[model samples]
Target: MEKYWNWEGNYIGVRQKDYLTACDGIILGKFYGKEIYDQNGNYIGEIGKNNRLIKNKTKENFRRPGFSFYVKGTITAPFKSCDPYPMIPGYEDFLR
Candidate 1:
Protein backbone atom coordinates (compact mmCIF):
# COMPACT_ATOMS: atom_id res chain seq x y z
CA MET A 1 0.00 0.00 0.00
CA GLU A 2 1.08 3.54 -0.76
CA LYS A 3 -0.13 6.76 0.84
CA TYR A 4 0.06 10.37 -0.23
CA TRP A 5 -1.35 13.67 0.91
CA ASN A 6 -3.30 15.88 -1.44
CA TRP A 7 -2.87 19.65 -1.57
CA GLU A 8 -5.81 19.94 0.84
CA GLY A 9 -3.93 17.60 3.21
CA ASN A 10 -6.29 14.71 2.69
CA TYR A 11 -4.53 11.40 3.02
CA ILE A 12 -5.06 9.27 -0.08
CA GLY A 13 -4.48 5.57 0.10
CA VAL A 14 -3.26 3.45 -2.80
CA ARG A 15 -3.37 -0.29 -2.80
CA GLN A 16 -1.38 -2.84 -4.77
CA LYS A 17 -4.69 -4.09 -6.15
CA ASP A 18 -6.19 -2.72 -9.34
CA TYR A 19 -7.76 0.71 -8.96
CA LEU A 20 -10.93 -0.25 -10.82
CA THR A 21 -11.65 -3.18 -8.57
CA ALA A 22 -10.97 -1.02 -5.52
CA CYS A 23 -13.35 1.67 -6.74
CA ASP A 24 -16.08 -0.87 -7.54
CA GLY A 25 -15.63 -2.38 -4.12
CA ILE A 26 -16.02 1.07 -2.60
CA ILE A 27 -19.20 1.76 -4.57
CA LEU A 28 -20.59 -1.63 -3.69
CA GLY A 29 -19.88 -1.11 -0.02
CA LYS A 30 -21.50 2.31 -0.02
CA PHE A 31 -24.70 1.32 -1.82
CA TYR A 32 -25.14 -2.30 -0.77
CA GLY A 33 -24.93 -3.56 2.77
CA LYS A 34 -22.47 -6.33 3.63
CA GLU A 35 -24.30 -9.35 2.31
CA ILE A 36 -23.94 -11.27 -0.95
CA TYR A 37 -25.77 -14.25 -2.28
CA ASP A 38 -24.49 -17.24 -4.20
CA GLN A 39 -25.57 -18.23 -7.69
CA ASN A 40 -28.13 -20.60 -6.16
CA GLY A 41 -29.73 -17.55 -4.50
CA ASN A 42 -28.92 -18.91 -1.08
CA TYR A 43 -28.27 -16.43 1.73
CA ILE A 44 -24.51 -16.48 1.68
CA GLY A 45 -22.29 -14.94 4.33
CA GLU A 46 -21.76 -11.24 4.50
CA ILE A 47 -19.40 -9.80 1.90
CA GLY A 48 -19.10 -6.49 0.09
CA LYS A 49 -21.02 -7.05 -3.15
CA ASN A 50 -22.38 -5.11 -6.09
CA ASN A 51 -25.77 -6.31 -7.30
CA ARG A 52 -26.84 -3.21 -9.21
CA LEU A 53 -26.14 -3.49 -12.90
CA ILE A 54 -26.24 0.25 -13.49
CA LYS A 55 -23.80 0.97 -10.75
CA ASN A 56 -21.41 -1.69 -12.06
CA LYS A 57 -21.65 -0.28 -15.57
CA THR A 58 -20.88 3.18 -14.25
CA LYS A 59 -17.83 1.85 -12.52
CA GLU A 60 -16.65 0.36 -15.80
CA ASN A 61 -17.21 3.64 -17.59
CA PHE A 62 -15.23 5.54 -14.99
CA ARG A 63 -12.33 3.16 -15.48
CA ARG A 64 -11.88 4.29 -19.08
CA PRO A 65 -10.02 7.61 -19.36
CA GLY A 66 -11.72 8.76 -22.55
CA PHE A 67 -15.20 7.79 -21.41
CA SER A 68 -14.74 9.47 -18.06
CA PHE A 69 -13.34 12.57 -19.73
CA TYR A 70 -16.24 12.83 -22.15
CA VAL A 71 -18.80 12.54 -19.36
CA LYS A 72 -17.11 15.20 -17.25
CA GLY A 73 -16.11 17.41 -20.17
CA THR A 74 -19.36 19.32 -20.46
CA ILE A 75 -21.79 20.96 -18.13
CA THR A 76 -25.52 21.14 -18.74
CA ALA A 77 -27.55 24.12 -17.65
CA PRO A 78 -30.62 23.68 -15.55
CA PHE A 79 -33.91 24.09 -17.40
CA LYS A 80 -34.96 27.12 -15.35
CA SER A 81 -31.81 28.66 -13.97
CA CYS A 82 -29.51 31.52 -14.86
CA ASP A 83 -26.87 30.72 -12.30
CA PRO A 84 -23.50 29.70 -13.67
CA TYR A 85 -22.59 26.12 -13.18
CA PRO A 86 -19.72 25.32 -10.92
CA MET A 87 -16.53 24.02 -12.49
CA ILE A 88 -14.64 21.11 -11.07
CA PRO A 89 -11.53 22.35 -9.31
CA GLY A 90 -8.29 21.62 -11.18
CA TYR A 91 -10.30 20.96 -14.37
CA GLU A 92 -9.51 24.32 -15.91
CA ASP A 93 -6.96 22.65 -18.11
CA PHE A 94 -9.61 20.37 -19.50
CA LEU A 95 -11.88 23.30 -20.26
CA ARG A 96 -9.16 24.97 -22.23
Candidate 2:
Protein backbone atom coordinates (compact mmCIF):
# COMPACT_ATOMS: atom_id res chain seq x y z
CA MET A 1 0.00 0.00 0.00
CA GLU A 2 0.98 3.63 -0.50
CA LYS A 3 0.38 7.01 1.14
CA TYR A 4 -1.24 10.26 0.07
CA TRP A 5 -0.70 13.98 0.64
CA ASN A 6 -2.66 17.20 0.32
CA TRP A 7 -2.11 20.18 -1.96
CA GLU A 8 -0.46 22.07 0.88
CA GLY A 9 2.16 19.33 0.95
CA ASN A 10 0.74 17.87 4.11
CA TYR A 11 0.36 14.19 4.89
CA ILE A 12 -3.23 13.10 4.47
CA GLY A 13 -3.57 9.35 4.70
CA VAL A 14 -2.25 6.00 3.58
CA ARG A 15 -3.51 3.00 1.66
CA GLN A 16 -4.46 0.08 3.85
CA LYS A 17 -1.25 -1.75 4.68
CA ASP A 18 -2.60 -4.95 3.16
CA TYR A 19 -4.59 -3.14 0.50
CA LEU A 20 -2.74 -4.84 -2.34
CA THR A 21 -3.89 -8.26 -1.20
CA ALA A 22 -7.35 -6.98 -0.33
CA CYS A 23 -8.18 -4.94 -3.44
CA ASP A 24 -5.28 -5.00 -5.84
CA GLY A 25 -3.88 -1.53 -5.16
CA ILE A 26 -7.10 0.06 -4.03
CA ILE A 27 -6.73 2.51 -1.12
CA LEU A 28 -8.60 1.90 2.09
CA GLY A 29 -7.34 3.19 5.41
CA LYS A 30 -7.55 5.73 8.22
CA PHE A 31 -7.01 9.29 7.17
CA TYR A 32 -5.36 11.95 9.26
CA GLY A 33 -6.37 15.62 9.30
CA LYS A 34 -5.97 16.39 5.65
CA GLU A 35 -7.95 18.79 3.52
CA ILE A 36 -8.93 17.80 -0.01
CA TYR A 37 -8.81 20.23 -2.90
CA ASP A 38 -10.14 20.43 -6.43
CA GLN A 39 -8.20 20.75 -9.67
CA ASN A 40 -8.22 24.53 -9.28
CA GLY A 41 -6.86 24.24 -5.75
CA ASN A 42 -10.18 24.94 -4.13
CA TYR A 43 -10.87 23.35 -0.78
CA ILE A 44 -13.22 20.46 -1.37
CA GLY A 45 -13.34 18.35 1.74
CA GLU A 46 -11.50 15.88 3.86
CA ILE A 47 -11.17 12.13 4.26
CA GLY A 48 -12.58 11.18 7.59
CA LYS A 49 -11.25 8.61 10.04
CA ASN A 50 -13.84 6.14 8.81
CA ASN A 51 -12.26 6.13 5.39
CA ARG A 52 -15.02 8.21 3.87
CA LEU A 53 -14.61 11.28 1.72
CA ILE A 54 -16.62 13.97 3.50
CA LYS A 55 -17.05 16.86 1.12
CA ASN A 56 -17.16 20.38 2.53
CA LYS A 57 -20.84 21.14 2.53
CA THR A 58 -20.21 24.84 2.95
CA LYS A 59 -18.84 25.04 -0.55
CA GLU A 60 -21.03 22.51 -2.32
CA ASN A 61 -24.27 24.47 -2.42
CA PHE A 62 -22.72 27.10 -4.68
CA ARG A 63 -20.70 24.87 -7.01
CA ARG A 64 -21.71 23.85 -10.47
CA PRO A 65 -24.81 21.73 -10.74
CA GLY A 66 -24.83 18.04 -11.69
CA PHE A 67 -21.70 17.43 -9.65
CA SER A 68 -22.02 14.22 -7.72
CA PHE A 69 -21.90 14.71 -4.00
CA TYR A 70 -19.49 12.48 -2.08
CA VAL A 71 -20.26 13.93 1.33
CA LYS A 72 -20.90 10.58 2.95
CA GLY A 73 -19.52 8.22 0.35
CA THR A 74 -16.34 6.28 -0.01
CA ILE A 75 -13.99 6.78 -2.88
CA THR A 76 -14.71 3.83 -5.13
CA ALA A 77 -12.28 4.63 -7.91
CA PRO A 78 -9.64 1.91 -7.64
CA PHE A 79 -7.15 4.00 -9.59
CA LYS A 80 -7.43 7.00 -7.27
CA SER A 81 -5.09 5.53 -4.71
CA CYS A 82 -1.83 7.27 -3.93
CA ASP A 83 0.21 4.17 -4.42
CA PRO A 84 3.10 3.68 -6.88
CA TYR A 85 4.02 7.34 -6.41
CA PRO A 86 3.17 9.99 -3.86
CA MET A 87 2.79 13.70 -4.39
CA ILE A 88 5.22 14.43 -1.59
CA PRO A 89 8.18 12.49 -0.30
CA GLY A 90 8.28 11.04 3.23
CA TYR A 91 4.51 11.02 3.56
CA GLU A 92 4.84 7.63 5.18
CA ASP A 93 6.47 9.13 8.21
CA PHE A 94 3.07 9.44 9.82
CA LEU A 95 2.51 5.71 9.60
CA ARG A 96 4.51 5.14 12.72
Candidate 3:
Protein backbone atom coordinates (compact mmCIF):
# COMPACT_ATOMS: atom_id res chain seq x y z
CA MET A 1 0.00 0.00 0.00
CA GLU A 2 0.97 3.60 -0.47
CA LYS A 3 0.55 6.48 1.97
CA TYR A 4 -0.35 10.10 1.26
CA TRP A 5 0.45 13.41 2.88
CA ASN A 6 -1.04 16.87 2.70
CA TRP A 7 0.81 19.91 1.40
CA GLU A 8 1.80 20.95 4.89
CA GLY A 9 3.30 17.52 5.46
CA ASN A 10 0.64 15.77 7.44
CA TYR A 11 -0.41 12.23 6.73
CA ILE A 12 -3.88 12.44 5.25
CA GLY A 13 -4.79 9.24 3.48
CA VAL A 14 -3.72 6.10 1.62
CA ARG A 15 -4.44 3.74 -1.27
CA GLN A 16 -3.82 0.08 -1.95
CA LYS A 17 -0.84 0.41 -4.27
CA ASP A 18 -0.90 3.86 -5.85
CA TYR A 19 -0.90 6.85 -3.55
CA LEU A 20 -1.95 9.22 -6.26
CA THR A 21 -4.99 7.22 -7.23
CA ALA A 22 -7.42 9.80 -5.94
CA CYS A 23 -5.36 12.89 -6.69
CA ASP A 24 -6.65 14.86 -9.62
CA GLY A 25 -3.61 16.50 -11.27
CA ILE A 26 -0.58 16.01 -9.07
CA ILE A 27 2.16 13.79 -10.45
CA LEU A 28 4.00 11.95 -7.68
CA GLY A 29 5.80 8.69 -7.08
CA LYS A 30 6.46 6.69 -3.96
CA PHE A 31 10.13 6.01 -3.29
CA TYR A 32 10.27 3.69 -0.36
CA GLY A 33 9.12 4.50 3.17
CA LYS A 34 7.45 7.86 2.64
CA GLU A 35 9.63 9.72 0.19
CA ILE A 36 7.59 11.37 -2.58
CA TYR A 37 8.71 12.96 -5.82
CA ASP A 38 7.00 15.41 -8.09
CA GLN A 39 6.56 15.10 -11.86
CA ASN A 40 9.83 16.84 -12.59
CA GLY A 41 11.63 14.88 -9.89
CA ASN A 42 11.64 17.36 -7.03
CA TYR A 43 12.05 15.89 -3.59
CA ILE A 44 8.98 17.24 -1.89
CA GLY A 45 8.62 15.50 1.43
CA GLU A 46 9.04 12.46 3.57
CA ILE A 47 6.52 10.89 5.92
CA GLY A 48 7.17 8.50 8.75
CA LYS A 49 5.57 5.11 9.21
CA ASN A 50 3.43 6.70 11.89
CA ASN A 51 2.22 9.17 9.30
CA ARG A 52 4.10 12.18 10.60
CA LEU A 53 6.24 14.54 8.62
CA ILE A 54 10.00 14.26 8.74
CA LYS A 55 10.67 17.97 8.87
CA ASN A 56 14.37 17.81 8.14
CA LYS A 57 13.82 16.12 4.83
CA THR A 58 10.66 17.96 3.80
CA LYS A 59 10.36 21.27 2.10
CA GLU A 60 8.64 24.09 3.89
CA ASN A 61 5.20 25.01 2.55
CA PHE A 62 5.86 22.94 -0.52
CA ARG A 63 3.10 22.58 -3.07
CA ARG A 64 3.28 20.77 -6.37
CA PRO A 65 2.85 22.92 -9.45
CA GLY A 66 -0.32 22.45 -11.50
CA PHE A 67 -1.79 20.75 -8.50
CA SER A 68 -1.93 23.59 -6.03
CA PHE A 69 -5.68 23.74 -6.14
CA TYR A 70 -6.08 20.18 -5.01
CA VAL A 71 -3.52 20.70 -2.31
CA LYS A 72 -4.99 23.96 -1.02
CA GLY A 73 -8.61 23.01 -1.52
CA THR A 74 -8.87 19.48 -0.19
CA ILE A 75 -5.64 18.11 1.20
CA THR A 76 -4.41 20.96 3.34
CA ALA A 77 -7.57 22.51 4.71
CA PRO A 78 -9.13 19.47 6.30
CA PHE A 79 -6.17 17.81 7.94
CA LYS A 80 -4.06 20.78 8.82
CA SER A 81 -4.87 20.72 12.48
CA CYS A 82 -5.18 17.00 12.94
CA ASP A 83 -2.64 14.85 14.70
CA PRO A 84 -0.12 12.93 12.60
CA TYR A 85 0.30 9.88 14.78
CA PRO A 86 -2.86 7.95 14.02
CA MET A 87 -2.36 5.42 11.29
CA ILE A 88 -4.69 5.86 8.35
CA PRO A 89 -7.39 3.16 8.11
CA GLY A 90 -5.70 0.38 6.21
CA TYR A 91 -2.30 1.23 7.59
CA GLU A 92 -2.99 0.15 11.12
CA ASP A 93 -0.06 -2.00 12.20
CA PHE A 94 1.60 -0.99 8.95
CA LEU A 95 5.20 -2.12 8.50
CA ARG A 96 4.81 -4.33 11.53
The prediction achieving the highest TM-score against the true structure is 3
Q: What TM-score fits each model?
A: 0.22, 0.29, 0.37
CA error at residue 75 for candidate 2, angstroms: 15
Compare candidates 1 and 2 on TM-score and give the better one: 2
Q: TM-score order of candidates, best first?
A: 3, 2, 1
lDDT of 3: 0.39
Cα lDDT of all candidates, in order? 0.21, 0.35, 0.39
Better of 1 and 3 by TM-score: 3
1-91 per-residue lDDT for model 3 (tens digits): 4455543444344443433322332334333345544444454455654454343332434544332323311132222334435434322
Residue-wise C-alpha lDDT for candidate 1, range 36-85, written one tens digit per residue: 22223322222111211111222221221111211111122212212222
Number of backbone collisions per candidate: 0, 0, 0
Residue pairs clashing in model 2 are none
Q: List residue ranges in candidate 1 displaced over 4 A.
A: 20-96
